[model samples]
Target: MYCPPAFREEELPALHDLMRAVRLANVVTSGTSGLHASPLPLFLDETDGPYGALYGHLARANEQWKDTPTGEALAIFMGSDAYVTPSWYASKKEHGKVVPTWNYTVVQARGPIEFFEDEGRLRGVVERLTSLHEAGRPEIWSVSDAPEKFIKGQLRGIVGLRLAITSLEGKRKMSQNRSAADRAGVAAGLSASARPGERLAAAEIPQG
Candidate 1:
């Protein structure tokens, strides 16, 4: 990601928080054939390493997993984003130099990729992922809730993936480059927006 210093998020805990808030990630890899990407619901294991590891599953039919990755794979997680109109900037009225831009948060994780078919490991991955997303639900679902034979058959159709993160980068472009007045204006404009994403982004803008 091309992140300016003002937008860069270098704190590990902050990066992990952004990653955990977003459920899906785009896992990209390169092989002899070319580049391939798959959207997967990855679960982060914070204690696995210094940067942490990611676990997810891919369909057995997905060819991306079959080809050997030439280098480290990338996983992208995108958080709340909103379009920022120049009209929201106070400087726009003063100098008419401001242009439209976007406010968003994102994390990119790169690591050596490994794919496995071990049924036990796959089941464990599935169970952990399920629990993560279903934590606050009225009726939480578990792998044991389904028939063992059915889950076993289902597991056969997919493969588990593990990426031991070697590098993690995060960017939070939330009007941090703007002046205090301009940022306040942006927050006010976004907070008044009907779009939920815009409203969420409004809360992320730094007040200072």
Candidate 2:
């Protein structure tokens, strides 16, 4: 999370929104095994802490949950990202100095990681996560949709996660470092591209 001043986003509300919008997060922890990372769909309990608590689950057998973290764990959430080509920068034609880069929104949550097997907590986390992702669907699913015995069995195979987030860092790189002309060129170029991510990035760029 090397956030330059121009790209850094320190607003808490914006960071929370970004984290929530990007459902899946990468949780990284260092342990005796060196480092382990798990891609999990995490839900943020904004009211739980100043920086918000994180909730998720991992396979019961995942050694990541078993090993004690050496220090703070990091949960990474990534939003729309796209490759920015030199051809999209006006500076490229002026001095031929512009190189390719990427535009993206990212949030990193650093905290102490806790893993537990309490069925009640696990059930609550799973149900909330399901509802968050299944909202507005044709047929929303719920934890109770499955048989109670079956649900219990399923829960048995997973472990619950809770992280009292101590720090939240966000960065939004959307051609903010480029000159006005170069930013406009990038927006136009990306807006005309077929890639959905590129188009999203285009709309994020500042337009004069």
Candidate 3:
């Protein structure tokens, strides 16, 4: 994460919010074989540690777990990203120097990676994950809804992971480097775009 001072977000609450809101994250690790990446729905627990902890699970057959990592793992969470056209920049009119860029929020977490296959831990991770995603649904289905034997059997095919985040880098690139008129133009453009994600990002650009 190459972030300048103006674009850096040092607020833990904001980082945690981004993580939770973007439940789908990319977990990357480097092993003797090289870099390995997996997209997983990881949840952040901010109650402990200087940074926090991440929890998720992958299919037991995934070979990513077999490759031993030399150190901590990296997880990337992305939120509200949109493409910004130079046509929206006031600077473009002045000298045509502006270029296209992205406006978004991102968090990079590095932590000790621990993988487990214990039935209880796997069940706990999967249950909480299910509950978290299902919280807003009108009809809620729980782990107990299924027979114990069946649920236990299902857990055998998955592996759980816990990563204690040692370092967290957060960035919010919301046109902070652009002129006010340019930012306003971008906001107007994004606010009217067909994509809801662009509209959400439009609302985040600072008015200054």
Candidate 4:
């Protein structure tokens, strides 16, 4: 991520918060064949390591797990984002120098990747991931809710992955580079937008 100093978010807790908020991540790896990527819903275990560990599963048929990865794998988690129009910038009226840009938050985790087929570990991963997303639901579902034999058969069709994070990069481009007046304008504009994403992004902009 090409992040300027004003937009860089290096705090570990903040990075983890972004990762936890975004359920899906794009897991990318480079192999002899080439680069392969999969969009997987990953759960973060902050206590696993210094930077933390990510757990997810890939379909057994997905070739990404078969190839030997050349280096550390990357997991990209994207958070709230919105389009910022120059019309929302006070500078646009003052000097007409402002151009449109995007405001968003994202976190990238790089780590050594491990793929396993152990049934017990796979079941644990599945259950943990399920619980994370289903926590606030009216009716929660569990792996035990299904027949054991059926669940076992379902697990056989997938492989579990654990990425022990080595490093984390976070970027929060919420118009931090803009003047205070311009930022306030952007926040106001986004807060009034009908798009839910835009409204969510409005809260991320720094008031100071």
Candidate 5:
């Protein structure tokens, strides 16, 4: 991901929090066929690795896993996003030079792609994914909620994936390049909008 200094996100804790809050991620890998991407719910295990590890699964027949990746694959986690209209900038009223843009947070994790179909590993992947999304619900679901035989049979139809993340890049573009008054305008404009993500982005404006 091409990131400029003004919009880059470099904090380790912040990056992990962004990834975890996003809930889902896009895994992209270049192959002989073409650039392929799979969007799936991901869970991270931050035990020992420098950047921890990523875990997820996809349909077994998804050819993304068929050919070994010749190099690093990228996993992208997208955070709160909002459209910033030109009217949100103070420059629009002064010099009238500003144009519409977008503000968002994103994290790109690149690493060696690893594939697994062993039942144990696959089972663990499925369980963690389920728990990550289902937690805090009134009636949380468990992997064991389904019949063991049924889950085993279901697991056979998909492939589990793990990436020992080697490089992690992130960016949070929330009108940081704009003047304080312009950014305040953006926050006020977005806060009044009904879009959930816009409201979220409205709160991320740095105190610059």
Candidate 6:
């Protein structure tokens, strides 16, 4: 994440918010075979360590769990993102110097990756993940909803992951680099976009 000072977001609460809001993250690791990345729904336990710990599962057959990483693993989470057109900039009328860019919020977490197959730990992780995602549903579901034998059989097909976060990097580019008028134009353009993501991003940009 090449974040300029204006776009850097180092506050812990903000970083955690971004990670938690974006439950699905891309976990990347480098092994002897090269680099491998997997898109996984991860749960962040802020109280687990200084930075925090990430929990999730990988399919039992996933080679990513089998390969020992050469270094730390990286988990990337992305928030609302939108394309900004040069035509949305006020300066474009005076001088066509503006170019298209993307506005987005993202976080990168780096840590040592650990994979486990312990039934108890795997069960705990699965239960927690399910509850987290189903917290507000009208008909809540739980691991206990299934028969013990069936649940155990299902768990056998997966491997658990724990990444003790050592560091975190976060960035939010929301037209802050643009002039006030340009930013307002950007906000208007995004708010009128048909894409839901663009409308979400409009709220992040400043208004004149």
The residue-level lDDT of candidate 3 at 73 comes to: 93
Candidate 6, residue 162: lDDT: 94
lDDT of 5 by residue, 69-127 (tens): 65788999999999999987878889999888999999999998888899998998898
Model 5: residues with Cα > 4 Å off, grouped in runs: none
Question: What do the candidate models score in CA lDDT, each in turn?
Answer: 0.95, 0.91, 0.90, 0.94, 0.89, 0.94
Write out the backbone clash pairs for model 5: none
lDDT of 2 at 84: 86
Q: Among all windows of ten consecutive residues in candidate 6, which has the lowest summed lDDT?
A: 62-71
Q: Write the per-residue lDDT of candidate 3 for residues 182-205, one digit (tens) a residue.
A: 989999999999999999999999
What is the Cα-based lDDT of residue 92 in candidate 2?
A: 86
Per-residue lDDT of candidate 4, residues 1-208 (tens digit): 8999988999999999999999789999988788999999999999999999999999999999999464699999999999999999988889999888999999999999999999999999999999998899999998899999999999999999999999999999999888999999999999999999899999998987
Residue lDDT tens for model 2, 39-134 = 999999999989899999999989998885546899999998888889978888889998899999999999998988999989999999999999
TM-score of 5: 0.95
TM-score of each: 0.97, 0.95, 0.95, 0.97, 0.95, 0.96
Ranking by lDDT: 1, 4, 6, 2, 3, 5
lDDT of 4 at 120: 97
Candidate 6: which stretches are off by over 4 Å? none
Weakest lDDT window of 10 consecutive positions for candidate 4: 63-72
Clashing pairs in 4: none
Over 1-208, each residue of candidate 6 has an lDDT whose tens digit, in order, gives 7889999999999999999999689999988778889999999999999999999999999888888654699999999999999999999999999889999999999999899999999999999999999999999999999999999999999999999999999999999889999999999999999999899899999766
Best by lDDT: 1
lDDT of 1 by residue, 1-208 (tens): 8989989999999999999999899999998788989999999999999999999999999999998664699999999999999998999889999999999999999999999999999999999999999999999999999999999999999999999999999999999989999999999999999999899999999987
| Model 3 pairs whose backbones collide | none
Candidate 6: C-alpha lDDT:
0.94
Give all candidate RMSDs, comma-separated. Answer: 1.0, 1.4, 1.4, 1.1, 1.4, 1.2
